[model samples]
Target: MSDHERKQLEDFLAAIEPNIAGYNYSTFSYLAQKKGNVFELAQGRLVLQGVPATSESKHFESPNLKVGFLHLHELKTSVKQFIESLLTGKLLTPHGELRFAPEKDRSHSIYFNPFHAEGVPFQNRQAFQYRQMQLHIRGDRRERLDSLSLDWELKAGPIPFEGVQELCAEFGVGQIDGDSSTVEIVAFSVAAIGGESSVTGTKAKLVINLVDGLEREKASIGYRLIERNAVVKRGILSGDALTWENATNFQRGVAELEVTGGAVLHCVASHGGRAQHHYWVADPATAQNPFRAIHQAFDKNLDVLQELVTKAQTKGANARDLEIAVAWLLWMLGFSTTHIGGTPKTSDAPDLIAATPFGHLVVVECTTGILKEDSKLSHLFQRAEKIRQTLISCGNQHLRVLPVIVTTKTRDEVKSELDQAHKNGALVATIEDFPQLINRTLLVPNAERLYTEAEENLKRLQNPSPFDVSGTKTNLLQ
Candidate 1:
């Protein structure tokens, strides 16, 4: 073996030390004294003989009696025979069986529980004690016996020390620390058997203890023979249906088995935890779809703008709200916006200035009342001029400016005044047309074309009759 493989083997041996310590110590103490260079366990049948009592003797004895001990060879043979009887006997469960054979190299005798047809071997040696049993298998080694170990822990549950002792006796397994609440059991190990390295089986037998209440006043035993890797369609199972007899695999490598109204999920493979047969309880809550919840929340927020429009008090405030809403809409459409309408020192500034995703700037001026033949038009021009100067100072070469008037009045009602303002080089739109204008600008394929269309639309709104060229092109020329 390579150095790394040797280290892994050493680690595996170190981890299972506690499991076999008790058995090794007891066996060593029993056979410590040697007649020659070796010592062995012996057994034989016992017989009693009688000796006759003498008149002068205080102790009575029967005459013509004899006692004899078996020879070492006979003793060894008898012991082996007894052990073979025990292994093939009904002492172990029907699902358990023993095997004794010679190692492949014929260097040592091999005796072990060879139940490879059973899933992973989870044997509870001492049925009465609160203990845990585990089987660890190493899969990397192909030749020779990969390490096989059966580990046992005692008093590993809520049961008291005396309770475990009684259980150990009931189960017919030796117990240590009879008075202590917790103890460790002897572990069993075997070198690999010939042609056997991986676990192969299709069924598992599970035994569980049920307590009636928290105080543990009453208890009962329950067992289920389940398929090794079955997928449970329903996590719950009735008492009679909990068995490997009717189970089927849900998917390759994964299996589920019901336990106490829940489930025990298992993953089996040829390597890693799966190779060693690891299992855990499946949680039901993790099966929910997360995106469904997100979509529900998204649909709920889609009508928020209409709700805000219905609840506002004044037309001016309503118009301002719409402007801010539109600015946010532009931001969501991949633009950066600044709301300057409410800043006292920047009153001449446009209500909003935004940088579009296509690398152009847009300035907007908003009004809640009708734009008539009055100072409102001059104020719009001043705001537009301020925005133009700001963009020029920042070295912005391409920009679009729009004057938006959101009023209760219809488009026809302010057509004359809107026409006059447009002649003075102001791009204007009423409340009813604002949304359409924004949509058109956003949907256009080219940013330059969007600005060009806005300018042409403004020119189309000018008076057809001859007018002063200087006044009409005032802001447009700049």
Candidate 2:
């Protein structure tokens, strides 16, 4: 949680991502702290914690980034138990000094709370702190938490370094200068807030914390349980509700859960801009597989345009030069070069990345082919571009911002803009050109990856079975 960043902090995030998946902030809160430092966190408001639907409000891939407040009281005791086992090797309860653990389904981000509060198992130590936020989630274990990863966040507070040795040693956190005014602790957290819920009988558990701004006061938020149904309506299966009209194999049950328990988390922080894409896995077995035969006349078939950009536009551009710059650019996007375009295309991005002999990094974007309408990443383009710019300040940032790749309808749109930024010395590509089956270099969606992210998006939405994602929110619960 931060606004203006320092060179060190910026550089740190540039190289070491703190699990910034495809999420946007919907809330921000700062607890009053007298002597401790306060770090701001703008995490995902909507979490992918349920089995996804093959279709959403319109389709079945991505829904709008959702938001909901979380509170310690709302989350049942054993909610984050699976997560605690992964980290502190304990269980979640209403007693203890303080502990941090991961949600079972989601491991990328961890939960923070007082091991146990003051007077009782759940008493407020600080009486002054009073800022809070509210969040709502459709209660479902299968509808909760997915994936797992580890990263860092900035936190400034007086270290209760006496008895927290177990926590610090486990996470490899070292004690730094004790200056409360200006010291950044490499706080540890885990999570991979992605799609496709496999948890069938789960509920969200809230975490209670006593540090950070809690030194003087308490910051609290309420967790709301909303009844969200993971279903698809038969009407959506018909061609009338889809943006991609050609999808004929369209069926409510086609979409299967790919990645389950993507480790979704929520925080009271308002944030803006595009972050990164977590290679969050969905249990394909359980996820809703949404890809079907649809009549999408809009598919632009940007393959030809992508070929022109990489083969023709990069006439004098060194493959190494492009890889270094673009890798660094996309790294800020929270994804390695594993998932590039939505699906497979020509001019494979993985090959391009492999050819780059530079010790540059690999950046990947996981835009699905079924989402784009005008070929562009659509609404998410600006955030991706912003992330590209944010990471450029890093010394050895190697970045690549691939284009959006969803369906055939988006082909023409991508074909023309394949090299929009190439003229300005930026490396860009569309899904039509990336091939990365054998190598882990490019994050291009295959039949499996495509189904996973899409299925998760569909399940996380509040819909009925056989429902269609027509005119629905496209943001995934990042």
Candidate 3:
């Protein structure tokens, strides 16, 4: 490749990175303890986790720094907005713009944008021209700059502990105490199937780990008897270990049944204040495949799926895995799914294209980050509309294309600026409603209904529910 082409490729790759810089930035921990209703925060030192200890010396701490309680309300909304701006590459702030600096651990840290500093000469200041290029090597032929300017680099700063302290004082939010609060940090992992389950035509044995102290609740065991690519029978069954009162720790549940063919089991147990699901396939060949676990394990394990979805933007491999998982999710919901984002590089089309046999089409774009300035919603909308136009030209008048953006961010965050997204007939699936969608898919497994619900959700956002002024009864002639 020519030097210019190589540089162009590098710029394109950087632009698509979740964080142009600071991809390896480390996070610090602070002391915090729950005291009654509030958490008492204390000064905490930063430590290297994956990075080496030698890099710690490069971090300079401001003198006389102390920690304070985590005030219930300390301009949290503003802080969130600031963080969102940084994540979205908007580079809007009262202070200088931020830039990525190299750390000793071969990682990057955020600092004030050095190129735009006041003392730097205008001509000498380095500028990275973000020209349009093929995000993926092949897929789309023409390359043109997108409407939004996504040229801002990633940024970071020192532990904002003292900064938060100063802000609290300035805003009269609270006072900082030199005394640190006592806190304990624990790494909690979700319950899983620790022991191997025996699967036969007559019965299946399931062993699961339940939380130590949490109350054990009811278990929902449902199965589908598949024969010749058809579900001959489907029903719920019960077992002893399905309930913890009868057994302890890793309990084994024996599901008694008589079947002549392979069966698919869906076992959900309620424990640790959450529902844990495990899938078992009867065929040994199916179990032997490497991706069988990812296909089945990740289906019901929403927690791990959520983490992978959240990291999709940052990690290329995670993005591919997320696409596969999403496609599997759609398939589970009875939709003919296509994972189009499996290209070696980023693709031009949406991540997934799914359709119900009845001509109900959905184009989905998945992201765990903010969808504000440099969002893919617009791109998705355009693609969906283009598909609709093409289908119409092909004389498929009954077909409908619904654009949906699935994000791991909460509903409130995605709802902050919904007018534009709703304006383009796009529905957002936030983290809050994502689990509901998954559970509903598993329980119902109706693609037609899901598409209808997606359309209704978009319509509801467009119209919204009417507000009542008063509770007074109005007389007909009053």
Residue 142's lDDT within candidate 2 is 20
Output the lDDT of residue 478, model 2: 16
Task: Tell me the TM-score of model 2.
Answer: 0.18
Most accurate candidate by TM-score: 3
Model 3, span 271-327: residue lDDT tens: 323333444345442332233344566344445555555465342334465566577
lDDT of 2 by residue, 317-362 (tens): 3333323323332332223343333235723333222112233332
Candidate 3 global lDDT = 0.43
lDDT of each: 0.32, 0.24, 0.43
TM-score of each: 0.30, 0.18, 0.43
Candidate 2 ranges beyond 4 A from true positions: 1-202, 212-217, 221-478
Best prediction by lDDT: 3
Relative to the true structure, candidate 2 has a C-alpha RMSD (angstroms) of 23.3
lDDT of 2 at 303: 28
- For residues 221-310, write the lDDT of model 1, one tens digit per residue: 122222222343333222233221211211111122334322223322111111212122222222111221232255343244333332
Local lDDT at 109 for model 2 = 27
Candidate 1 runs further than 4 Å off: 1-301, 309-318, 332-335, 372-376, 393-408, 434-449, 463-478
